[model samples]
Target: MKKITVFWGCQIPGRLTFLEKSTRLGLAALGYEINDIPEFGCCPEKSLIKNEDEKLWLLTAARNLALAEREGYPLVVACNGCSSTLKTAYVKLKGNPKLLAEVNEKLWEFGLKLGGSLKVYHLIEFLADEVGAGVIKQRVQKPLRGLKIGVHPGCHQNRPSPAASFEDPLNPRKYDILVQALGATTVEYQSKLMCCGNNLTLAGKLDDGWRMARVKIQELTNLRADALTVTCPACFMQFDQKQALYARQGDILNLPVLTYMELLALALGIEAEELNLKEHRVDPSPVLRKAGIINEPLPFNEEVLKRCLTCGACEYDCPSARTGVMSPQGIIKRFLNGEIEELINSSEIWECVECHTCLEYCPQRFGMEKVFTWLKHQAMVRETYPNSLKSGYEMFVKTGRLAKIDDRQRQKLGLPSLSSQEPRQFVEKLL
Candidate 1:
């Protein structure tokens, strides 16, 4: 049996335990053996990297990869951030012989040499490549049955990829292939390729964060998506669990968000509870219940902590706020407001489209979407009608679409018209 090292980062253990389960089981079901890298610890993450200690970051990553190299197996990471960091460190070292020597010199302390021979892959890439989508397609006991699904791959995964693999970082389809194997249809939304607004949480720009998710959610809802699926835990937090946070201030948009594994597990005949669907802050139970997968709604948790330092790094990178709706100043006002809950529940927070601009900029590693997610949960509890989000909610309910603009809107806006049959499709066409 072939075996690989599982790099379980910090977030997977504390925040996304089921991801570990789904990846472990999903791969096991496919006959690939996996083992935990016991010597491994935190990837030090983006937060620690900011301390300006490039050498430490490089050495640590090299050490982890070397562990896999020593065992003569490839290194596999479940977290998008970790995958990006580990892969980037390897690339940085391999590309620069001098830096490689320095890092390797440090590695000599641990009885390791960094020649960068280890292969690091994100879970999605490994599944589509190693497990073989055809095999997954054949094992679909409970296919998604053409259920509408939206995908948001995190930014870090592909930002550094000069040569694309698995899927385009800007427009990922690896998850879509798995979704299709489960008999689901993927949504073609404007921000479908956008980053989740997680990074913005570190910055003080909550509004910018909200708009990123809002834009994507609004698009997906307009596309009539049944649910949103994401690979990264942070992406999962922004798009799926934060709906309630954005709903409180104004209109509420209801969309069930699930991990790629949870969906795969459901298709593989695993129970919802076992996959931790109930733990999602956005309350996916109603959506799953509506699909007849569950009889009753599961409990929804809204855990709001203290205010983030409000760095506004989220606004710095948000594409929507950069283009429309919430401006930089507005982001600060919401995050700096006296009534934190009211600020979070406000309609301004509902405008995000889930693009990951904020996550890309935040120096603090705060989750910019928390305010919005908390608000969405509050609105759900109060049974309040979401005013800012009505149009999107109605769109999904009406057309099974997630975009307000159709081919006609494209034409009116002077955007190239998509052909009914072949206007031009890229990601899906590639698949």
Candidate 2:
């Protein structure tokens, strides 16, 4: 077995210790022994560099890395900020002989060197590479059959230059594929690709966070998603535990935010208490209950649904509208004019790609995708819809496929066909 130093850092223990524990459990189950390095302090995140105290952050991160170096193992960080800082510092100090001198001068106080002896890694990187999703799939003992989940791969983990090479920044399926191995269905929604409101949270801007989250949740809810799964701790806090505050302010949303480890824990047949499911500030029990994964409804408070402001913010930013798929603005206007009931059967509504761009740009916290979702649900339930959707709908119903382009057409356009004919069980499971 390979030796690896587990750097819990500080934030994971304070707020997301469950994730830390679950990760350890997940990796251990995969036959890896992770040695804990607890003496290391905070990574100081971006502040050390932003404050022009690169030595401080470097020393702090290096101290952690040095422990791993001494232990003859690479350091694995669970926090995004810590992971970014450590990896960046390692590369930076290793490249510049001058910066290396400066950082080493500080490290000399603790008898350490600022050389390239330590390697930094994020847990997800290892999971995607060494441990591999195949191993995870094989380890799944409890298949989450009735769940429809949305994955939020947080900006730091796979955005603005990914932390890992294997993680495709723009389109990631590591988390989703792992979820599938556990017997759950992953739903692609408008906000599935959006940022997790981390910037808004850091700026002490609650409204921005609320608006961003509200739009995201509305889209996921519209898809009838059981939960919004995440890999970042800050993202887990922002989306999972902050809903009640947003709801109290009148923009009602019911979406459970779960950590990737929690999902893995459930799949590994770990009990709820061992996974720390109770500590989530947001009550996930309702969504779980609705998915039939649990018995009782979560203690989520219900609020009176407010009428959409019809501001067309969602329309302005929606890619579908830009691509001439549907008039998101027009739908809002028509709905306000008491024509939504009539518009449900129209192909215009089904044309939405379910991207939450409109929600991001909307001045009001109105989730327009929810309207689209409601329309889709009504169509499926009532069996009333347009002929234009017949192609996609039949593909979904008969072949468990969605939006498959002709193979010849795709080759003609120099594009690879990404669509596949899925199992009927998977499609029906989602519905």
Candidate 3:
């Protein structure tokens, strides 16, 4: 068994202890020697601190690496952000002598030196590559059969490609492969490679961050995905917290977002209570019931849905509203004014492009998009769509693209080939 120092970065230990718990349970089950050093501080999280002070970022990260080096064990990080920071610091200090000297001078006062022996590994990659998916599959006391999981690798896990060499940066397969070994099917969805938008929130673009999460959630919902699995704490917070926040404002996603470790623990036959499923904002009961992991269903809280009607910010900024065919605000007003039948019958509901702009802009953080989405579903059930809409749907189903891309024309223009195949495949799976 290989011994490694587990760096349970600030987020995990401070807030997401469930992730920490699951990670320990899964890793222990795998028979790895895990060591926890109290001296290890924050990976210092690369985004905010690094931007503010580069030297401080390097110093702090170097200190963490020094602690792991002193232990003579490679650092295994559960958070993608922490892995990126620590790994980047390791690569930088080893390659740049001057910078390493500067950092070592700072560490010398504390009886620590940034050493060349320290290596950082994201826990997901460690499990996939080092532990081997075969060993994991063999250890599965309970396979997650008949479950459809959407994997969110988060941005930092496989980027700054030279530093994080474990997985492909663009099209990662390790997370998907790891989950599949547990007997669950990974669902393909749109923007599967995009960031979870948590960083945007830190940058004060709260709506933009939620928009990133909302789009993915909407696509997953369309795919009828059972649950979403993420390896990063920031991504988990974005999906889990924002999804719950949206649920409170009547935009109910109801998709249980699980950390990869949590999912792994479940496959290892760990009970829901042990994994702290209840701590999650969105209820995991739907996923639990689907997996036959739980018998009793959790009750839905209707009070959370009562708040979205008052906030019309989503409608005010809606592009569809500018067309005068009934805005999100107007639809909500009509519903509140006892015109539910008229609102459902109106073709304006279908005009929503599902851009999720409304969801993003709402002050309450949940918008009229859910209301319009429900109406659109009702229209589909009633077969009340216009001829143009029917034609567009038929075209997409037939050709797998909203509009054809002429590969010959691109070739003639000396341009690179358009990457439409992957998206087309996603569309096929989604449809």
Steric overlap count per candidate: 64, 6, 0
Top candidate on TM-score is 3
TM-scores for candidates 1 onward, in order: 0.65, 0.64, 0.68
Top-scoring candidate (lDDT): 3
The per-model lDDT (C-alpha) reads: 0.68, 0.69, 0.79
Question: How does model 3 fare in lDDT?
Answer: 0.79
74-178: candidate 3 lDDT, tens digit per residue: 779888999888888889889999989988998999999876977678888888878889988998876676678898888888878889758678888999999
Q: Higher lDDT: candidate 2 or 3?
A: 3
Model 2 stretches astray by more than 4 angstroms: 1-3, 47-52, 162-166, 286-431
Ranking by lDDT: 3, 2, 1
Candidate 2 residue 185 Cα shift, in angstroms, is: 2.3
Residue-level lDDT tens digits of model 1 in 237-307: 77755677777767488877887777777777677777766667677775554333553321222221223
Model 3 reaches what TM-score against the true structure? 0.68
TM-score of decoy 1: 0.65
Candidates sorted by TM-score, descending order?
Answer: 3, 1, 2
Global lDDT of model 2: 0.69
